[model samples]
Target: MITTFPIVALFILLGLAIPVGLVMALVGMAGLHSIGGWDMVSGIVQSTPLSTAGSYELLTLPMFLLMAEFVLISGVADDLFRAGAAWTGRVRGGLGMATALAGAGFGAICGTSTAAAATLSATTLPAMIKQGYRPDVAAGVVAISGTLSMLIPPSVALIIYGLIAEVNIGKLLVAGIVPAMIVTFTIIATIYVLVLRDPSVAPAGPAVPWAEKFRLLKVTGPVLLLFAFVTGTIYSGIATPTEASALGALAGFGLALSSGKLNLGTFRKALVRATYGTCMIMLIILGATIFGYYFALTQITQDLIIWVQGLGISPWIVMVMIVAFYLVLGCFMDQTAILILTVPVIVPLVVALGFDPIWFGVVMIVTAEVGLLTPPVGLNCFVVSRYSGIPLSEVFKGVLPHILAHLLALALIVGIPEITLWLPSHMN
Candidate 1:
């Protein structure tokens, strides 16, 4: 009853339209009071926020967010899309493929999925639609492509998962590289197949001259260098993740300035936006910590682990069930809320079952990527739809095919753990 009450209340509060962080804190305090009175609640309420927000690792969040905001204001997404289209535009559904390619590149620097989706929708959707691409097909491709932001390095989602799961943040970031590449290509392939089956959905464009293609490629150099600088320092052990994020933010500022985009007004705007984003994430972390304390007091995770062990079931079966649970959960919850709420409970059970936490983190993230596209609360889909002024139904229709690509990517990562681990293992 103790365990069930908090979980049940959480859903009810969320369904009632309460903010996620407040709901978590309320349920947690109520549950703690039920178990250990106000003294326990008092002590936790005072400490959890400080401890959760005080970590040096937490600094990485704002820095990376600021970096993304600066990059967004710099107009790099347009450059990336133009370069991508120059190379891929001649092929059937080439513009769609180009959006995916550009999305992955932007994701490497941007990190947050919604921002990436909004930026791409604003920059690429009009171009695709202008080029005679089907609106639904173009919108769908933009929404799913934005999900790559959360899978690539500097990912805000991965950083939060690492902090909560007690895994190495650096390793978690590096681990995403290969799986992200696989998913990127999978999305591109899906676009090609869809265009092939129904050519009207995406018409091919005039081929670019080899000289113009090479010229356009130069626009990609600054983004590539920024990615290389950020990831290279982290992988080479030359800087901590926090240090890398700070440097990346500085590089982004420089990029914006060089492009004549940065001014006092734009700089202040980025700071304010990054500050707002950081505070929201920190509040969620604070609430999750308080809730985690109450959850730990209930001893549910330990009991669940023991119970599962005694079931005599194959571990893979258990793994599939957990993944399925996330898929359902993703349909309703935001990705950050899902991670902060569940990782505390799920990581221990996963470790007890002999799975690698790093591998599971990647799988969990890929699953979250799927959630970003699924209906009801598909955050990325909503962002794309709002930014592109497309109807929500068309955006949903567009993502149906890419959802299959996400599932295929998820299956490969789950079945072949090396796809996620090998690069991290090789990192210096």
Candidate 2:
């Protein structure tokens, strides 16, 4: 069954001519018939959507997406970039560093990699290039920084992983904090070193006066407030993650309106975009639900777990191998597809190895995040490349350092579980 089902599924994926959601759903249906019968497949199809979507947790998806859209449409990315540039631009290679920091900050509110890359590239890349930053560095920083999407609070990938693993979504979110900050700083430091070695690659921006530096903070102040409110509410037990998402979305809209950035066309576009994002996510969820069931019924999940335990290999090695598999898959698949296809098989393996599911959820998010910067199908690189009109090769070249930073962060989390577990521990 493994040979046949996965083979068929691979061929379907390789076709790459259909919506991934439809492919997963069809594959699941085929697997169901092979194992059970048409009756079981029929039942799962009827019930999967309601089972998957009729959850309070899912409200976070659209709400967080909407909040991000509002900020993007309202010109908040520009403000944040300006503030970051004012503070860091004076240092050699500072613009690239500032772009990474700003991308991380924007990522705090927005959870989608493609969105962060698009927004940051549009707002930051042209300015960096104009300031004499090398196209490679300018494009690379934006590509990598967009990966903050999976590390920051309200990350859509983490939310989906939580739902599938039946772990606490709020706890998983809290766990991402340290890893996210570490990655952002690591990327910044890498940029500093790269530019120092090749001085001509980055030139310094004029120093802003202290007064002007402080003045730029006003542009980003409200954004910080929104981030704090959304994440703070969840940590304090004042609301679930989904509820906080709703509040955050409304706050984002209000912020945009008060800033005079909201218009009929912009507002309409944001809604349309949010709806589209929500639909795409839901379709994947539905597909995963069906596909995951096939694995369970076929005993693939159980047999794989037993075989791994019996191998007498260090569980840590198994865990590392699993993460490595994700890295390879991420090179070709989108973040959503990676989660949907692997979480079912991988979750049981981790739990059987005595690792905390919540920690693994955080780890999975961090691992999947590299997809945004990986080659061939890296979404963030594509988004930035499209926006900056830079060649895809340059964007990929730029992302290499950031990808190393991402791997460093992933290695740290794996070697010391405390980094991911600490925040969730304090929450309880």
TM-scores for all predictions: 0.99, 0.97
| Off by more than 4 A, model 1 | none
Residue 386 lDDT (model 2): 89
The whole-model lDDT of each prediction reads 0.93, 0.85
Model 2 misplaced regions, further than 4 Å:
none
Residue 76, candidate 1: Cα error in Å is 0.5
For 1-428, candidate 1 gives per-residue lDDT tens digits of 87888899999998898878888899999999999999999999988887888899999999999999999989999999999999999998999999999999999999999999999999889989988988999999999999999999999999999999989898899999999999999999999899889999998889999999999999998898889768888988888899999999999998899999899999999999999999998888888888999989999899999999999999999999999999999999888889988999999999999999999999999999999999899999999989999999999999999998789889989999988999889877
- Give the range of the ten consecutive residues with the poorest summed lDDT in model 2: 1-10
Per-residue lDDT tens digits for candidate 2, residues 294-405, read 8887788888998998899999999889899888988878777778778888888899899999888888888887877788788888888888899999988977877887
State the local distance difference test value for candidate 2. Answer: 0.85
